[model samples]
Target: MFTNDTPRQGLLGRFVAGLARTRQGLAGQIGRLFGANVPSAEDLEALEEALIAADFGPALAQQLMTPLHQRLSRRDLSNLDQVEAALKRGILDILSGVAPPPSTMDHQTRPQVLLFLGINGSGKTTTIGKLASRLITEGGRVVLAGADTFRAAAIEQLGLWGQRVGADVICHQAGADPSAVVFDAVQAACSRGASHLLIDTAGRLHTKRNLMEELKKIQRVVSRQMPDAPHERIMVLDATSGLNALVQARHFHEAVGLTGLILTKLDGTAKGGVVVAIADQLKLPITFVGLGEGVDDLQPFVPETFTDALFARS
Candidate 1:
């Protein structure tokens, strides 16, 4: 996995490689517009269209371009470098508008609890495993709670990850009470002196009302034992879901007040700009981004790195 010790260029290269599809979509458009020209008003308009095409949403696309349009009219934007620089600046401003997530392992709160939420097929479980693997590799003990008891396969999947990562897993039989599993997981993590407790909750979106209330119940269960616990209510969203990913974040944030996001499936999606839309609209910071299937691919979300990779020529 990637750590702070990793070199900057190597890390940026990994991000660029992962965002190839997205770069091909958005950066491709920018490349077409900037060329050797000073970029006319019509050219800027076309770039705005490309932003929307990349799933930045119409409102944000316009918001991002309006300033460049003004600078262009005032003859401030001189060349291709200025155009790309202006766009990258606009993106970083929005992405860093919110504060970053707090430290993952707070010693005072031993067993820093993290709960993962998302709709089915959002790569929620896999993200948890990858994150837990990183935590353990960092010399932190992790106890995983398999609260997604709705599906037998989910419980089994979590167990497999637990074994693979050498973390203890607390799960119940399929269809068992999810809260009960959480209650036990909290106790296990506390007793074992674990540094973190990661819970994988059910993603049964079809049971809408029940699922939302169930998530709230899980929070309550964790709080009863360790107040201010469940320290991170992070949503694991699929970047490929596009606008629907934004919609999913809205629901989870409204229901249980999500603390941050971990976007997955960025490896093959051209709609990675949805990352911008989610952050711009919801004000939730993205914690991690899944670039590939390997555990090492889940890199900590770096706003500058992501923006550079997004705007890099494909």
Candidate 2:
């Protein structure tokens, strides 16, 4: 169970701190350009350049500049505060459009299966561990399925997480068939009456057709046992990958149908603006963000908090 001392304020503070680099790169630049002076055309151009530099992508940068351009054309002289507010509104608009719907899992389905997808080194294993910890704290009986039999180390790593989180781990030997592993895991979960079954599959590059097909096969195996199984198919994205992350999301969503995204390594990267690009272009809701290395650092994504963090005063 989560400790009572884990205050809401603390989590929000962490969210802000994790976004420090991004805010510095984005809001810091804007602040220097518009501080105390009415932003001129050159200032606005520099602001747009900063947005693009922060990984907002060219398209989103243009959209964010639209209101500024309109205000400038109208000669609506505005203070730095007004410019900041306009920028915030623009970012919030993009994020809010792709806000996720409330999550609901049918209790009748027995073990609610959640399948995680991402390329290697995208932190899929760590995300699963963090999620398992959260679910267990919420009083749910959880089981982890190590379907990443391609890597013995992955199987071992998941086993360690299962032990740490006090959840059962269903795994097969290295080089074993991943689909077969899932087949057994579903049966185990059903028999044990687990509330949640978290499946960790082998990480493969999005460009690998065979690996993608393997993912589809695993999905098929799960559905055959429980028609509504694999209740959520979430793609874990490495935020530091910038535009490459967007490409990976697109391909994976096309291949296996992603229900949401979990962006990891947010704290270490300055290109956090990729969050906006991903939401605006793909329209995929970001469900959670990995803020730090701690087990509890993976918090549910809140657009308002994120926007506030990005534009936070120095």
Q: lDDT per residue, candidate 1, 107-148, as tens digits?
A: 468889999999988888898898889889988899999999
At residue 288, candidate 1 shows an lDDT of 87
TM-score against truth, every candidate = 0.95, 0.94
Q: Candidate 2, 306: how far from true, in Å? A: 0.4
Model 2 lDDT tens row, 128-205: 999899888888899999999887899999999999989999999999999999999999999999998999988863
Root-mean-square deviation of every model: 1.8, 2.4
What's the alpha carbon RMSD for model 2? 2.4
Candidate 2 overall lDDT versus native: 0.86
The worst-scoring run of ten residues by lDDT in candidate 2 lies at: 1-10
The top-ranked prediction according to TM-score is: 1
Model 2, stretches more than 4 Å misplaced?
Answer: 1-8, 101-108, 205-207
